[model samples]
Target: MVSEKENAHFSELEKLVESIKQRQQVVIFPPGIASFIAVNILLIASFITFFAPVMTIIGDDWEMSQKAGGQFLVILLAVICIVPPAILITRGKKNLQRWFILLSSALAFMAALMVVVGLTMNNEAIAYQSPPLYVCIITSSLAAFLAQTSHYKTLTLFYYLLHKHE
Candidate 1:
């Protein structure tokens, strides 16, 4: 009953879904490599964001109490968002890749909370600064989401590669 065009469209949709499902496939990698990659990116980004600006502000005679707290907030956000997922991935936790994407979203929400608190309580007009409050929020959210999802994806791929032994 399906028209030729409808059949082709259905076929394309099927392929797309399969591709998404493939994200769940766990492929094997050298031990520690996956975690190393993920953690290094996170740590490097955190260090750059934290010390670089704070040091710059210090060198430029900016108020230490004013900027230090905001920098601390930013680093705290990064750590909270990054560390749990990294630990989960590194430890090879079961179903981590399957569920932690959603789980770490809680950390993302917490990171957002820090930004809001920073803006309100810090008395430094922390919102809408360059890189902006919202952008920082979005960046932290994206990092947390990506870390958990990618770790999950990597685990899935790793499982698929190991399936033959079972």
Candidate 2:
């Protein structure tokens, strides 16, 4: 019951799948890795630039920007590094982890935006102050988030659609 056209289609699908499997060994780069790295660097720089200077300028009463507080940023960055590699190692089709990666990337992007905003502020008296840095941080963050989320969602949806009948 197989026509030539159907057989040709099957052959093409087979070749596509094989090609994908072959390329799976390539080191796939995630879109958000740069953002994560930038965030980490900015966090350290902010601690030094904003916090240290503020402390020296105003003494005990003036606290550092609490936006990049605690080990959360570190943990987030580690996750950013770890998750993509794990997915790449295991291949990116594992549904749960794939979703996790997308969600985590979104969070990190948002955090970076917050940090960028915190850094650009001219206010020394406001808690979580908003400054001109808000513009770049927020704009970049929004762009990063939108691109990663869109790519992730599109890939996930495509995979599900492809396998839906099975």
Candidate 3:
């Protein structure tokens, strides 16, 4: 026969398990469709950025090789900030949404840094690009915020689902 204290402990444990099971059923906000679209846009932008340099090189414009090389490096940085999140989302790994947020944040930071650098250098070409860069920064920041919020909600649900009493 179970002792009184043992029975009480078992009861408490049962309640805890039940609570976790209930939490496991909690509704999570699915990843925002808008954020997914924004990620795609970022990916596309990175691709465009990447190809811009290649196109210049192919144009037999040797004079702009230095500029093209710099653009290529920037494009590579953008790819670093974009591709992983796209892959994670495409694979339906909601648990990794935080990576989306981090990548988006990095993109936004890079855009802002580009703006600052352009202003500091007073380069007309860079200044001309600032408006588009600003737009990108805004969208990327929005995507990051959405991804972070969704990730937390999903994380809670994921935790409970994994820990639910079987």
lDDT of 2 by residue, 53-138 (tens): 33343444434554334234544554564446434423435364344444444544544554554466643543243332343344
Tens-digit lDDT track of model 1 for 22-79: 6854424454355445533644353444344434534456687856766676677656
The TM-score leader among the candidates is 3
Q: Point out the worst 10-residue segment of candidate 3 by lDDT.
A: 49-58
Candidate with better TM-score, 1 vs 3: 3
Off by over 4 Å in 3: 1-95, 155-166
**Candidate 3 lDDT, 5-87, residue by residue in tens:** 85675566456546655675333335544546565576456345334433443444555767667667667766666677556
Clashes (backbone N, CA, C under 3 Å), per candidate, total 8, 0, 0
TM-score of each: 0.36, 0.31, 0.49
- List runs of model 1 lying over 4 Å from the truth: 1-92, 98-104, 118-122, 125-136, 147-151, 160-166
Ranking by TM-score: 3, 1, 2
Estimate the lDDT of model 1: 0.49
Query: lDDT per model, in order?
Result: 0.49, 0.43, 0.59
